[model samples]
Target: MNAPTSPHILAAAQRPIPDAFMAALTARFGSQCVTSLAVREQHGRDEGSLTAPPPAAVVYAESTQDVQDAVALCHQHEVPVIAYGAGSSLEGHLLAVQGGISIDVNRMNQVLSIDTEDLTITVQPGITRKQLNEAIKDTGFFFPIDPGADASIGGMASTRASGTNAVRYGTMRENVLALEVVTASGQVIRTGNRAKKSAAGYDLTRLMVGSEGTLGIFTEISLRIYPLPEAVSAAICSFSTIEAAVRTVIETIQLGIPIARVELIDVNAVRMVNAYSKLDLREEPMLLMEFHGSPTGVKEQAEMVQDLASEHGGNAFEWAERPEDRTRLFTARHNAYFAAVASVPACRCITTDTCVPISRLADALLQCVTEADASGIPYFLVGHVGDGNFHFGYLIDPDNDTQRAQAEQLNHQLVQRAIALGGTCTGEHGIGVHKQGFLLEEAGEGAVAMMRAIKQALDPKNILNPGKIFQIG
Candidate 1:
């Protein structure tokens, strides 16, 4: 197994946007070019805790050539270029600290191809996950990498995102097969073919998937998709303690039960969702699970998981098999973060993401929950525990320095513990600006040096999404 790479890195010192670059962008994009403070601010920060200076301008790019032309202009002046997808990033991935031009790809959203024969769909980067599935729904195949948010495929590729179904369907790394990227010099390049696997050369496709746009901007993506399951069922099992809920998940995974999705929502999260989404779920540590297979197979999978949970003193699994019922269950889980923050007035959700080996999940999660509770910070717990990944949203009063400090302290300790247990600093959420320190601790100097070398080789001018993942200088 590879040593985990760090998820986030420090924001590198940024250079001022060249005046000539702005003139060039405005000239090239015309009406699409926006330089208003209000527009720039809109393109600046993400859903993360960090606040960065907005870009000097934002250009809506409607085609691959537009991206190349914009990149060319930026490359000419050695200006930074940040790719903007759906603006749904959680790690400040879209912050334009150096102030360049943001290339908004939302207009490029179009279903380019759907080859059901190969079970692959080629799409523009800006297409959201939900839209992609709906477009491909009638074909009997669906894109399964659901990262809770209807995040853009381009952003999802950049961040290497995953969600509850990752345990079964895998993350972006497993689902993404090929890509079309615009390099720093505005060169368009194809990373891989539509083949199932390749050993022809460097796995550039995988490299670009999680490059976080530091290397190049994704213009198109080809994703390997799966057929819709024959039968799907969702359930929830409430546990008296977080330890018990997590242990049940660990046991289920150890036993090789093919559960499609397994999520952990603690008591606070349950309460928030109950009030926010208006669903009266038991306010305790709970496991939200889904099973996919033939009717009998789904039943067996659910039963096996139920027995495992029961052994841990979990309540009887509440089943939600109908489509509407299933949607209600997952919707609450999807909105868990917002619900948590909304539960506390004037609070911000500072999240910590850590994923460990299945063997270490029980201990790792227990330690995390205990420390978070001990800090006396109002927080909610949720996890894609089927894959040994989990998140804690530290709901903090943003104005309260002491509360912020406590949350960061707890997050730091948990990240170190995850690293010790052979887990990545980030499970699904890619490093943006917040986890830069933890990235160093996870990936050693040598590995990070290699990454820096790659960044320099691919983007010599440092024009493409600079100061992300790992800073070049």
Candidate 2:
């Protein structure tokens, strides 16, 4: 297989769009609406280490009406419309493959309403997870679909993102209750109600949750919130081997421990995190954990988990009770990707996520480590292991064809092993452009066909986030 070239290189150097098309876009959207050079380049890229393709124009949408009008215009012109959120997607979700319009929703960042009694908050599509949390901090409540980065709430819902808290609270699929979406035809429709469980009709709200913005543009969302935990305790436990650490997690979950967060970091990840965050953590495979509840309840849970870890050969456990200490610990954990990237000079990080059955986690992780070692690919491993989901970050020199090919081979083998263990190719990140082949292999022809039907039924014109989830003409 050939190395993946930079999308920008392909678009600008190999497949540049005609000037007449740019003139038509400007005529339709006006001068203030269209951005060409630097702005277009920036909007087309994302947190994913892959090279970005500049959208022909980047439009700053101000309201739902703006999105509707923009999509309507694109539909009429038979051009592709790619929705842009915080640019934090790891799977090339925002790259403008057809290169028409990058509809940026940043200006629409507004908390529409806060239903305190109902424990739900309604917000515009552009509102980020961190901004929402900060706005609702004083209310003693929070929306917890955290994807590490302060990603837009819409993007989180679109990608079905889950992070540290997913072990306890669940992912965006459980958090998002309703959505006001603009369809491909520029028609706005509400998906569900604020009421918890509805059996009235088809569950459209969920169908859109991990659609990767291929179905419609989410204009507003009503999300579930939870009261802040009464007590919170965080700790770190080191182990000699990654397998031992993962086995401890599996055992803890099997024993019905109500742990709020249990993340596994391989020895390599621990080293990179220490250097990146300037902390002197022991460079060994470790489990970073947290518990939430009454002080007594948290203590009991921690003790129970400590016993399980001991059985798995876990070393001394270090607990952090102070708020500042807990904050610093989790902050470093969240920055694991950046730390991994920083460890390698002039190399881009390619991350692959896979989830397996709890009993198979140890085997899966060990296999991943062995593959990386055998290939001599510099990599780091970290995961929400409590959910049996883990990620591998491979730092590769994309310019080197042999190195890039080897990395892809390793990634493919990892995905194959995960699927063989009855897990998914992507645990949280949706099947955007990068993992479409894996998705087809895992889900099979029938499932892929059903997904295509849904896409066609909702977006007949193929204008809503074209060339994502699965490739289209």
Candidate 3:
């Protein structure tokens, strides 16, 4: 059970939007300012189980000026403001919990400029990863961050999201080179230039990358792009047990093999993918891997992986060299979240993402799965184990109080274990609302106090994404 708060804690109160603010926004945005219930409700929730109440209104921002104007007005009224991208967040990052304004940036999707020579791309914040890749696929280059949701670049940066490719290309923190952000008072500021490296002041670019929209609104982003590999091959390997599969990942990473992608899915997850995506595979723990290099280089990597797998009781390595086969294999793996949730009818899934040190992964994972299994809650287990990161999508009936409690308890235990193992409360997923408490535990009083001080200094009015990350008076 959660500890009752101390008497000094102040309860969060939802403030009503003033009529003057609404009138001003509508006049400034014309038809783009939406206040209808249908639209407001759609912008309120994301893909997560927790849906905060809808915002009082939604402003479709088309450019930096639009966002600046809207934020300025909201700041003037001292109303809460939340930034909305694709609404693909797993945590309640985009919800307007304090009944203020939601500045939607999806309409701002546009690839502004591409610099092949510099190997960088500048875009409006709302462009999706797939869409960005599609626009530049013919250029022999692609963006490497794939959070599996077709999520917006702005949202990806907001949550600092990562996925299977992170083992090779790094997360948004490493790829996002610079940003154009609107401050709390609606002033526009650029963080950096196109330089590959900088010894500049403060590193504000890194600061906004994972701020979860509580710090500033991202109006534009510059990202590092990678050259497409000459040869890419994918394969699936079955293991005798989950522990064996995890051990194989440990060995592979320890050997310093520059693998492109390595993901783990337990037998139950494989079964769900087989049912939902309609593919026949062995009902056992599995590792889905991909290698990006020259033909001979990938072949050499495959041999090394095969040897490592065999040492751990793994069997039946199925390789996919053809483009269609590779796409199909990755598609199924990327859709693991949907497949898992679909396994149970009328259920809400809580995808608990925790990352431990590579050495402690197997131990931490065993404890998490054991506790989840013992709880009798239905779940699907998957992980990008190469980086010691994984998620278990706990399926629970939304309306059933007992199921929700059981699922929360299961998450609490798993997060506690991960923290004890010198891991984080979240890896790729940012510290959205759900893990606020865990953030306090993981970052401790000093670090959190420092963060709060910075936040207070920047957003003194406390109007930006209030009730998220941490609670402050």
Candidate 4:
């Protein structure tokens, strides 16, 4: 695999945003069109450490027409249009690498439709996961594709995100069924229908689902939602070693257990979360798991998992059966990134994620852990281990080049190992600015060439989030 690219590259390709375009945008959007440096700076960065000049301006788009107008203006001016949502992406997905205008869709938050009979909900792109769940709570359905953060459905779909529950309910690639997209030329088009399956033409919905806003900007998304489980139980089991915890997960999956979620939190992350979230979690390699089904089925699944954990030297399961207790537990798991960030003062996070086949997970994880331990870097480990996906957030002082290089080296090794073991460089995080080289190495020349060809065909002027996913030739 190619080495990790530096995120400090200057915006040498930044094109000027014409005054006429700004004037037109302000006329069309009124106060929604903001040139404030603070807003631009806010829209420019993401959770990871990558840096770039802020977009020339920001537009708070509240409707599909608003997005279309903004894109049309950008296309007319040949200015990059970066779609901004909740700003939760970790791989610099929101960075405006080339000078442009950011179309902030968070103001477009609304639920367009809910097909309770069909188990589908169509929502505006700006509605977050928590908001969606809340909106549908009375209807007894919840969106299952949670990427930890209360990310916007549009952003989640853009990244093809999967999280703790992905092992059971699948990712955005599976949950998202239809889309209302604003093309680079500011044309609104609908892809697919709310039907469960389709054999009609190209699978454009899937193509745009994880395009990271390169192909099109999502205005409306129709998602498959699931009924709240009949019974739910969450438990945490401490393991003597990370390997044992991973092995138990592998065995549980191999046995075809329908586990809803199984996440691994290393000792360091557990410590961080304990302090950051004010919880007294066991300071050992632990698996935070949940079982969903009928009461009997949940009980059976938990017992089987407990037995498997016993074989691997996992301590007794600490159960969180009440809804409030379960929420607290999962909230802590979701807050792990922040917890890790707080562990190091003013440190930039160089985070990386990789996934391998279930059988090779132990091999892939242990080697990387050893390398990380030897590197003497302050880092935290966490994973949705049931699906063989894990992340490392290496904390580095921004001024320390050596620490950054060491972190990058460790990231390189981990990605290479994951790819070599028949896995991917990024299991959920799309190839934004950070993983461009790795995507090329993983998908190879011909595949990425086709991706570029697709990008060129759909976005001829490349106004939609330029310089992301893969660099245009």
lDDT of each: 0.88, 0.86, 0.89, 0.92
Q: Which candidate is the best by TM-score?
A: 4
As a whole number from 0 to 100, the lDDT of residue 155 in candidate 3 is 93
lDDT assessment of candidate 3: 0.89
Query: Candidate 3 residues 330-401, lDDT tens each?
Result: 899888889988999998898799999999999999988888888888898999899999999989888777
Task: Supply candidate 2's per-residue lDDT for 102.
Answer: 86
What TM-score does structure 1 among the candidates reach? 0.97
Top-scoring candidate (lDDT): 4
* Candidate 3 Cα errors over 4 Å, as ranges: 1-12
Worst 10 residues of 1 by lDDT: 1-10
Candidate 1 segments whose C-alpha is farther than 4 A from its true place = 1-14
lDDT of 2 by residue, 73-191 (tens): 77666677888889999887888776677899998999989988999999998989899999999999988666688899989999999988999999999999999998888889999
Ranking by lDDT: 4, 3, 1, 2
TM-score of predicted structure 3: 0.97
lDDT of 1 by residue, 55-79 (tens): 8888999999999999999998988
lDDT tens per residue, model 4, 212-289: 999899999999999899999999999999999999999999999999999999999999999999998889999999
Residue pairs with backbone overlap in model 2: none
238, model 2: CA deviation in Å? 0.6
TM-score on alpha carbons, each prediction: 0.97, 0.95, 0.97, 0.99
